[model samples]
Target: MVAPMGYLPQLMYGALITLGVALSAVLFGAAFGLLGAMAKLSASRPLRAVAEAYTIVVRGTPDLIIILIVFFGGTIALTRLFGRTVEVSEFGAGVASLAFVFGAYATEIFRGAIRAVPVGQIEAARALSLPAPILFLRIVLPQAWRVALPAFGNQSIILLKQTSLISVVGLEELMRSASMAAGATREPFKWYLAAACLYLVMTGLSTILLRLAERRANLGYERR
Candidate 1:
C-alpha cells in the first residue's frame, strides 16, 4: 500500500519527537527511581511504606490510565491550588506519566541490584574509614550499576514504546503522525506498518547501544 507522497518527512519528524520524549522520560525516571530505591531501603518504616505503595500502585495500574490521571487530574489539582487555569502540554503529561511508571519498575531493579552487592565489601569499605558518600560511590554504586544495567536497558525499551500513549493526549509523535496520516490517506495498513518499522529500528539501535554499555560496565570482571 502506497502512503501519501508528502507524508514521509512528517513521519520522520514525528519519529524524532518520539525519540526525544523517550530519552527525556528515561532521565527523569532514573532520578525518581534512585530516590525511590533509597527510600525503600531506608530504616524508617514510613519511608519504606511510601516507596512500596508508590511502586505497587503505579505498577498495578495500566499505563494509559496513569497517563490520563496524571494529565487531567494533575491539571485540575494545580489549577485549583493556584486559583487559576493550569494547562499541561501533551509532552509534559507524557514524560511525567512514563517517568513515573518507569521509576516504579526501576526502583525494584535498583533495590535488588543494591542488595546483590556483597555486604562484606561495604563492611570492608567502612573499615577503611571511607566516608559514607565515598563508600557508596566508590564501592556500592559501581557494582550495583553493573547488576542493574540489563534490567534498566529493558525498562528503557519499554519506556520508548510507551511514548505512543502520548498520542491520546494529542502529542504529534510517531504514532500520532501515522494515525493522522492514515485518517487522511485512507491507508491505515501502510502508515501503521511504517510506524512499526520505525519503532523496530529504534529498539534495534537501542539494544546495540545497551549491549555496548553493559560490556563497558562489566570491564575488569572475570568473564563467565
Candidate 2:
C-alpha cells in the first residue's frame, strides 16, 4: 500500500497525544516526588522508611515491567472489585506507569535539592519564630527549585523520551504511529527517520525552554 501524503498529519496527531501524556505524567510525578522527598526527610522513621521503599522498589524495577503491572494488574483489581470483567485504558496505564518511574527518580533529585538549601537559613527562620509553612514557602522552596532545575530538567526530558514506551500498551502515541506507517508502507527508512526528527524537534524545543527558565531562576541569586 502506498503511504498517504497525509502521514505527516497522522504523525502530528500522535505527537500531540505524546505531548499530552508526557505533561500529565510529569505533573503527577512532581506531586509524588514532592511528597516522597518530604517523607524521606521527615523526622518520623516510618515516613522515611516508606519513602525509601518507594524509591528503591520503583527504581529497581525496569519500566516495562511496571507498565505491564499497571496495565494488566489494574484490570484484575477492577474486575474483582466490580464483580465483572474490567479493562484499563492504555492511556491511563501508560501515564500511571511513567509517572511512577519519573517520581522515583525525581524524589531523589528533590531530596538532594531540599537538603542543599542552607540549614542556617531555616534555623534563622525558626529564630524569627516564622511558621514552618511560611519558612518553607518563602525561603526554602524557591532556592530548592533553583538548585533542582538542571537535574529536574534532565529527568523531565528522559520522561518525555520514555513516552515511546507507551507504544507497547497500544496507545497511539508518536512512536506507535511511525511504526504502523512504516509497517504498512514498507518504507521503513523514511517513516522511522521522520519519527526521529519529530522527537528531536520536541526535545530540542524543551531544552531551550528549560534553559530560559533556568536563567530566570538564577536571576535573583546572580544579583546578590
Candidate that scores best on lDDT: 1
Candidate 2 lowest-lDDT run of ten: 1-10
lDDT of each: 0.94, 0.93
TM-scores across all candidates? 0.96, 0.96
| Tens-digit lDDT string for candidate 1 (1-224) | 54486888889999999999999999999989988998999999999999999999999999999999989998998999999999888889999999999999999999999999999999999999999989988998999999999999999998999899999999999999999889889899999999999999999999999999999999999988
TM-score top scorer: 1
Clashing pairs in 1: none
For model 2 the TM-score comes to: 0.96
On a 0 to 1 TM-score scale, where does candidate 1 land against the true structure?
A: 0.96
